[model samples]
Target: MLYRMVTPEHICPFGLKSLDLLHRQGFDVEDHQFKSRAETDAFMASEHVDTTPQIFIAGNRVGGYDDLRRYFHQPVADPNATSYQPVVAVFATALAMALAGTWATTGTLISVRSGEWFVAFSMCILAILKLQNLETFSNMFLGYDLFAQRVVRYAYVYPFGEAVSGVLMIAGGLFKWIAIPIALFIGGIGAISVFKAVYIDRRELKCACVGGSSKVPLGFVSLTENLMMVGMATWMAVR
Candidate 1:
């Protein structure tokens, strides 16, 4: 038996998770859903419980989602654990898109332009993530970014600059004069900032590269991103 809240306003996510788990474990579950907050609260009060999605197997209470996971010997996620998943996902997607687009347009996957497209695509995607919530990204960026800390407004303008640089770079280097400088300036400053915060200052902080809410550690990945921009800019300038 499984008792979970399924109100009109909000369906409890853990309840769905619990149901899926039970099914996967080959258990036939009798679902008992509370359709309103009042009923859920009253049941909770009567049972001396604090949360929903309570599971019962063969008349034995298996508790909530995490508790059920333990019963099944499954690993539970740590909320505070540092994860590179988001950044990896973004970069991987960008690389795939860059390769696919290059092949579709040029009839080949390997070319000098392939690398350029990869970096440009990465920049645009990263900028899009940061631009989703400028205020949040700005606040988090100010924590360790030297330029943003000093200028304040630079944090907000940073994403737009990245987007512009990326778009111009993708336009076949025709606007190299404009794109190169922006990429160099932003990338140079970012590299230094990340280096100081992570290597020199020995500060442990979250990266704002993906977004403010991401838990990506402020270190190598961030530095590499900046370095890619700098290298791309320098190459474009000289070529």
Candidate 2:
């Protein structure tokens, strides 16, 4: 395969990824680096291709990064594909940690309030994921979050609020004064925004529950996050 690599100014990340993919697939690649933008443009014009880094397999043009992926029968980008894998994995890990945490502290996983521990830990774990890429999370959140649409800053604050509430809840509801209110308030807004966007507005979108990079769909799991908060807050209030 022949590949024309770019300069530092026009770095193509997927070019590297595609090259690696080709290497793993046991294809001997002859890669060339374009010294200048003019050279690169000339190469593109000569080949009649729009983007790079392109691959040519046995004199057949394989197009750009995505086209290479397709030629290799690999899954490229599909925005419509609703992915629950990230959210499911995060929740599963959080549940395991909650069980381990409770067992470590109480010497038992099953208790009267074990559910609380699970929910608290789940929120904390999800919030931590969002906090990992706050900018990405906020950008994804702006898609469906009503407050984020209006205020914009709320998208950035949402993760912090979730993290605080989850941590407070994990402390055996000691800070019910603060935790309960945050849970209810955020959850309420989240649920309403999701309902309006997914049901009323009927738009297809990704959920920012696991963070902006996640592919979790904006419907069931999104609503569940909000409902979980409301439920946790209500339980805290009653108890």
Candidate 3:
């Protein structure tokens, strides 16, 4: 048996996916839906479950969609899978955009200008993701940032600093003066923090570079992010 939810304003996507999965897995499903919010709440309360798309297999409570997946021996979309895939995807998109921009401007991807553009865009995107939920990012950041550990408020400020300076770096004028110094200071701090946390201290931590929801580890990938900022800042300062 399956109990799912659908509403006028929003339908649970997982509920639909659950039904599909059950059908594919050759389960005989007695599907049911919550006709209204009150009924949904009552059902959830009665079942003592927080979410819908719940399943019962042979009269045994199989739980939610993810739980059902586990029952079927399928890999659930677990975020803490400790893969660099998220950062890789973000960086790959940035690289593709950078190459396209370079080609558009100079008819080649080898343009001197494209390097900074790539760096700036990457930093900005990372910052935006972090800024989406400042509290969450700050908490994750405090796990490793040397200064943020000592001074908690620095965690809150870091993402905004990255975002504003990254945008300034892209603009490239008097703003470069502001952007360059900030990047160097922050990046230098970050690189050291990541190195000490992952290498020296041997801590297992999630990176806040791509934001709080990211499960990217505190290792070479995170160190590279900081190092890239430092390199970009140095180049901008000298040029």
Best candidate, TM-score:
1
- Measured against the true structure, the TM-scores of the candidates, in listed sequence, are 0.96, 0.72, 0.81
Whole-model alpha-carbon lDDT for candidate 3: 0.86
The root-mean-square deviation over C-alpha atoms between each candidate and the true structure, in angstroms, is: 1.2, 4.1, 3.2
The list of candidate 2 runs beyond 4 A from truth reads: 6-11, 35-39, 103-115, 125-159, 192-216
Candidate 2 vs 3: which has more lDDT: 2
Kindly list the per-residue Cα lDDT of model 3 for residues 1-239, writing each as its tens digit: 98988889668898899999999998888889887889899999998988887888989998998898899899888654887887887788877877888898789986777777788888888888899999899989999999889989999999888888878877864578788888888899999999999999999999888888787877898899899999998987777
The sequence of per-residue lDDT tens digits that candidate 2 reaches over residues 160-226 is 9999999999898787999999999999999999999999999988899998887778998989989
Angstrom error of the Cα, residue 108, model 1: value is: 1.1
Worst 10 residues of 3 by lDDT: 169-178
> Candidate 1, after superposition: displacement of residue 175 in Å?
2.6
The lDDT leader among the candidates is 1
Which model is ahead, 1 or 2, in terms of lDDT? 1
